[model samples]
Target: MQTSPENDLVTIEEAAAMLGTTTVNILMNLKRNLLQGQEIDGHWHVSKASLAAHGGDTKAAVSKPLCQRSTCGSCGQH
Candidate 1:
């Protein structure tokens, strides 16, 4: 739950794409503490750092800041 501007958080779908996996697997990983993420407004936001550390494809993750996304109401902190 410790989110800061330095930590780029991606939505579950984005994380799945970065890791090349399904959202369900990502959710299980999050619950198992195999990944680092936080739940925000009923949605799961995965940590880009953790994803990269776990060998995920960083290039596949969103290049722009999450704040720029249309669904920024819940992720405008960045």
Candidate 2:
């Protein structure tokens, strides 16, 4: 992936494009508290770090486990 300076504050639309997702999806993530953001100028803003850490999907970072599950639903096999 190309590295470019990101806007200090990015809107849902811009984030969605950068993350290769839909605005609705991004919005949902924000609503579910899956993504880290702040309300500035009456708009939500996401950090570049948050996006990069989650592979553009912050929810996946927290909700999904590192390993595939065969026994334990949250992570690896028992």
Candidate 3:
């Protein structure tokens, strides 16, 4: 789904993408009360304002590493 700045709500996935982080990071933030969101229909809906306050920019693209393998020990995926 497409979201505009005028939109107040965003999904957890969207929030993660905006922050250039993973969904698990967003969930951890939510659990720690670092980010604000509401659970609806088994999904977490985050506030765009909250994300912005946390330095999450919807227009900012995430930088990908040269290696995209989950087995990379540098990313703790191994």
Task: RMSD for all candidates, in order, please.
Answer: 12.8, 7.4, 7.1
For residues 2-71, what per-residue lDDT tens digits would candidate 3 score against the true structure?
7533368788888877787788767766775767888877888787777777443432322223124465
| Lowest summed lDDT window (length 10), candidate 1 | 58-67
Candidate order by lDDT, decreasing, is 1, 3, 2
Q: Which stretches of model 2 miss by more than 4 angstroms?
A: 1-7, 56-78
lDDT of each: 0.67, 0.61, 0.64
What lDDT tens digits, residue by residue, belong to model 2 across residues 1-78?
A: 332234555777777777776776666667666676777767767766667778645455544542333543434344
Better structure of 1 and 3 per lDDT:
1
Tell me the deviation in Å of residue 29 in model 3: 0.3
Q: What is the C-alpha lDDT profile of model 1 across 1-78, one tens digit per residue?
A: 444333689887877776776787678667767678988778898887878875435433322333355763424554
Question: Residue 19's C-alpha lDDT in candidate 3?
Answer: 81
Top model number, TM-score: 3
Error of 2 at 45 (Å): 1.3
Clashing pairs in 3: none
Clashing pairs in 2: none
Return the candidate ranking by TM-score, descending.
3, 1, 2
TM-score of each: 0.61, 0.55, 0.62
